[model samples]
Target: MTRIPTLFFATAALFALIGMAWGIQMSASQDHALSPAHGHLNLIGFVAMAVFGGYYALNPLAAASRLAMVHYALTLAAVIVLVPGIVMALRGTGEALAKGGSVLALLSMALFLVAVLRHARGLMR
Candidate 1:
């Protein structure tokens, strides 16, 4: 019943591990140029996703809905693209992916708000 929550945690853990490794790598190389990207990876990919999972676990009614899955997908996509986007932008590649990923992140937050609002409505029933 908590498939989404479990998925979120699993993905978050992976992101956290990657972020940690990235941090260590940067430290070893004495290059903090990509710290911004690493920070986002940990904050968005690990912390935010883990928080989303906790929220879903607390509100299974919302978790059971399609919106939850969509939220997961969108959030995951945001993390996937956004981190790389930041890196590419930092490398002077382009701003396209960063812009797109920012939009996805915004949309994901909106969906999360919708889920929270809907859950509140259900609670009043």
Candidate 2:
């Protein structure tokens, strides 16, 4: 359980650094335009992953069962779709992968929220 948090924090920090580097490069390149990659890295990689990890750490039981696979799957799904979607979106490709990726990301968040809430309620009793 703690490992989940540790991994999450580490992953988030890595993405944050990458995002900052991308930002610095953009700034130095005379292009103030926003790259979807920046948002994806920050939101999906750093923020979302950290939240999922926190939830898992706080509720170890959630990670002990098959549902753990679901959690990991959803997060991976988000990353899979999100990363490519960001690159495509930034390139002005109006495909539906980005939209679909967003939906998957939302689904992942919902899964995490439900799991955390259920765990919290279990603790209260």
Best by lDDT: 1
Error of 2 at 47 (Å): 1.4
> TM-score for all predictions?
0.96, 0.80
| Candidate 2 global Cα RMSD | 2.2
Alpha-carbon lDDT of model 2: 0.74
Q: Report lDDT (Cα) of residue 94, candidate 2.
A: 67
- Put down candidate 2 lDDT per residue, 21-115, tens digits, no spaces: 98899889967556776778788888888777777777777756466567667776777787778678777986577788888888888887777
**Clash pairs of candidate 1?**
none
Model 1 Cα shift for residue 92 (angstroms): 0.4
Tell me the number of clashing residue pairs for each predicted model.
Answer: 0, 0
In model 1, the runs with Cα more than 4 Å from the true position are: none
Model 1 Cα lDDT, one tens digit per residue, 1-125: 49999999999999999999999999999999989889989998999899999999988999999999999999999999999999999999998888988899899889999999989987888
